[model samples]
Target chain A: MPLNADQAHYLFSVMRLAVGARVALFNGRDGEWTAEVVEAAKKAGSLRCLGQAAPQLNPPDLWLIFAPIKKERTDFIVEKAAELGCAKILPVQTEFTNASRIRQDRLQAHALEAAEQCLGTYVPEVSDLQALQALLKGWDPARRILWGDESLVGPAQTLAGLTPGPWAILVGPEGGFSEAERAQLRGLDYVTPVSLGPRILRADTAACAAITLWQSALGDWM
Target chain B: MPLNADQAHYLFSVMRLAVGARVALFNGRDGEWTAEVVEAAKKAGSLRCLGQAAPQLNPPDLWLIFAPIKKERTDFIVEKAAELGCAKILPVQTEFTNASRIRQDRLQAHALEAAEQCLGTYVPEVSDLQALQALLKGWDPARRILWGDESLVGPAQTLAGLTPGPWAILVGPEGGFSEAERAQLRGLDYVTPVSLGPRILRADTAACAAITLWQSALGDWM
Candidate 1:
């Protein structure tokens, strides 16, 4: 397979790889494969696949839906979601969301980088910023949403006794979910309100913590 | 009580607080208090305590000891530790730890800011960087240490069945613990090796995840 300029530079200059060096490769769909460097150059390179190293290990059917915050922190959410084995990442613009738009390409790149960093065989897809209301309108009831409710802040209400199938963890913005949004979420049958802990975690920390809790209770972490 | 120059700037310049404005205050000892700004200035300020807002709620006796990574990430670890209800933050120098030193004052400031952000009444203390071996040598057998063992990376080994007492979570550096360090930790009676999840988590992510797991299982979050 042909390597991109950035990949070529990373392999040749950064990693100091040359011809005949074996590199692990994954394409989201295919399992990890051992590829030999056929041609290595400053800005271009090619690799020949030797054999599959490991089977593809996709994350459980879990999505991370969060209201985007600052640029760096939003990037952090996406990166951590990928590292924590999230299946998909959706950045929603809630009533209290400060950022109206997000650079989807940048966040997607962050997910890819996080996957690479964690030696993940698959990279979770990062969706563009969308309205939380619209997403809720078309929400799949089969997929349960674990809403991080600030009002329930105290002891963590564990995911115990809650059976997991298709699930997503919803984290609010820095300003927190509006009253109307909270009411709507509470009224929904599919949305389960959960508390992180006694302290009010920042949006980024809440996202990661929620993911950890879900994974440990109902997802693949078990 | 008198506010320092930085606190004065934070109140008058950043927060735009004026005389007669009520502000919540905590000294990590006394409970949170409602204070009115009796005297406000550019470089100096004073407040008169009106009443106590909330009782001092200290986190469970939990410590987060980690090998410092990059500068920004180290700051992140301290901030999250404070937000996550860690009683103390300790930076340790391991065999593979790249950073030899850490700014104790800056990290302490980060912890304080995190406490403020989280509305925490108590701020976790950030200790100066020290050698991991020295820390282990003086380790208390009563306080069990949950080690983030990378070798057991696939699936999180739950903290269930482990009784809670004084406990600490130890996260390794990016390069992971040296073989000698791992052997030493494995042989220690007080150390309990645990896995975060399937993927190779970055040091910062591992620290937060480990703390979450501990909190959910045995800490106040339960």
Candidate 2:
């Protein structure tokens, strides 16, 4: 397969791979394969697939829906979500969300980059920004949402005994969910309010921690 | 207590906290206290401790020893380690470590900032970078080290059934441990070789993941 201009530049200029050098390649659909550099140039490159190195492995059907924070932190959330084996990443605009808009393509690119760096066969799909109310309106009851509630004032709760199935983790904004939003979430049967720990965590850190907790409790980490 | 110049700038300049403003303070010895800013300036400030707000809370006895990676990522490791409730953070220079030197003061400051941001009462002490061999030479027999060996290719192992006393998580360098280093770790009776997961994680990610797994399994998170 012919490498894209960016990939070609990364291979030839950044990695300095010459022709005949083997590289691990994965398309998310096909298993990871060993590819040999057949043609290499500064701005263009091509490789021939040698053989499958490993089977295409997918993470659990877990989704991460977080309110976008700062640009760099939003990228961090996406990148960490991918690395922690989230199947999908969704950005939602909450009542207290600081960021007005998010670049979906940029976040998707970050997920792809994380997958490559973490040596994973699958990249989580990053969805466009959506309103929290609208998302709740179409909520699927079958999928449990582990709500990382910031206002939770008590000892931390464990994710043990949670059913192992389709699950999602919801990380609130920096300012946390508005009163009305909290009430709404509290009223939902599918939402399980959880605390990361005793201390308060930033939006980005909470997102990463929530994923870690969920993956360990109900996801594939066990 | 008199605020340092950096703290004064952070309060008066960055946070725009004026004189007479209330700020929470903790010295890791005393409980968290609500202090009033008696004097506030961009470069100079002071606050009188009013009263205790909460008791001093300490995390479980957990140490994180990791080989430093890139500059930013190394900072990230320290910050995350502090936020995740590590009792101590130690940077170890391994055979495959890429970075040459680590600014101990800078990393300690990062831990302080993380503790302040995360509302942690206790700040994890960031030790000066030391050689891995030297660290192992003085290893405490009672404290078990959860060796995050990248070479262990398999499903994630549970940290259950392990003694719940003083413990540490050891994350190797980006290039991973040398064969001799792995052998040395494996030969040690106090070391428990463990895998983060099936996928290969970056050094920083592995540190965070290993901590999360350890905390969930045997630390205070349970």
Candidate 3:
């Protein structure tokens, strides 16, 4: 198993990991595995795979579609998506999107970092920014969008009640879902309008809340 | 009811909430009630209580106990706790707690801001920093501690499965629960060890996850 230099520094120096120390490794594709350091250096380290520690637990085929916010907040969402086991992350640009574009590579790095920090076995794919219309036009019916919307005018539904399948969560930008975008989403057959609860959760909070709700309802938790 | 400067600015500038707008306010102790903006000032605003719109839905009497992290992350926890319907937020000092000290005033402000943003009637109180032992010493039988711990060595449990009552969620620092702290928690009768899931969530993530789980299991969602 290979670990980047950042991981090496974290394990060797900050965490004081030594040669022969057992470590866990997951490539998002493989299940959690145990590895022992064969060569440990401050800046570099090598680990030989020992055995599979746990069978791969695939995240529910859920994608998180959100309007990219500020740079740091967007980065935060990406990291959290990886930690929470979103299968994919699509940064959508809405009318109120504060950010013009996103650095996909940097976001991907954040996802990797979040995965490493949480000892997660998965890293959700971070896609390039797409216009809301473009994403909606291309959304696959097999994978539906559980829109994390706030303007719904009724009692919120629990994720527990939703049937498990290919699902994704949609969270708007700080300004919230525009009328046109909301109308577009409401018109889509693949989009399920769901509110997290009575309170208005921020985009980041909504993202995490939706993931947990989905996990509790359909993912491994149930 | 009083709206802080930032909230006033938001109401006047951002949302353009005009005078006499019907709003609601809750101070945790009082139930949620409708109110009208009696005075709309750019820097501050006052409201006149109309009546209780929604009778006090006391937060299962849960206390959110978490280690002090960075200012922003800590603030995030406080804000989310208020919106998640936590009654109180206690900043705990643990072995791996890296932050200098908890900013009670700033944190309290965050809670209030969160309440205003979510249109929530109640605000969760931000408590001063207390050592873990000090907190345990004062543990009341009436209030159980729902430890949002990640190291539980068994099948994961859901908050949706729990019966709501007086409870506190203990979120460890970024480094995680100290070995000694875990041992102490496991030995406590009032401590209920619940897992968010198999994934290792950050302290902030764990806080929100636990609250969501608790609400789904036993709060107003019931």
Say which prediction, candidate 1 or candidate 3, comes out ahead on TM-score: 1
Model 1 chain B: worst 10 consecutive residues (lDDT sum): B152-161
lDDT preference between candidates 1 and 3, better one = 1
Indicate which candidate wins on DockQ: 1
Query: In candidate 1, which residue ranges exceed 4 Å CA deviation?
Result: A4-6, A13-16
Indicate which candidate wins on TM-score.
1
Model 3 chain A lowest lDDT segment of ten: A152-161
- lDDT per residue for candidate 3 within A136-169, as digits (tens), equals 7776788877888888623358766676788988
**Can you rank all candidates by lDDT, best first?**
1, 2, 3
lDDT of 1 by residue, B142-174 (tens): 999999999998889889889889999999999
DockQ numbers for every candidate? 0.85, 0.55, 0.46
Model 1 Cα lDDT, one tens digit per residue, A1-222: 899999999999999999999999999988799999999999999999999998898999999999999888998999999998899999999999988889999999999999888889889999999999999999989999999998888999978789769999999999799999999999999999999999999999999899999999988889
Clashes of each: 0, 0, 2
- lDDT (Cα, tens digit) per residue for candidate 2, span B121-191: 89999999999999999988899999989987456777777789999999998889999999999999999
List the lowest-lDDT window of 10 residues for candidate 2 chain B: B152-161
The Cα error of candidate 3 at residue A159, in Å, is: 2.8
- Alpha-carbon error at B129 in model 1, in Å? 0.7
Clashing pairs in 2: none
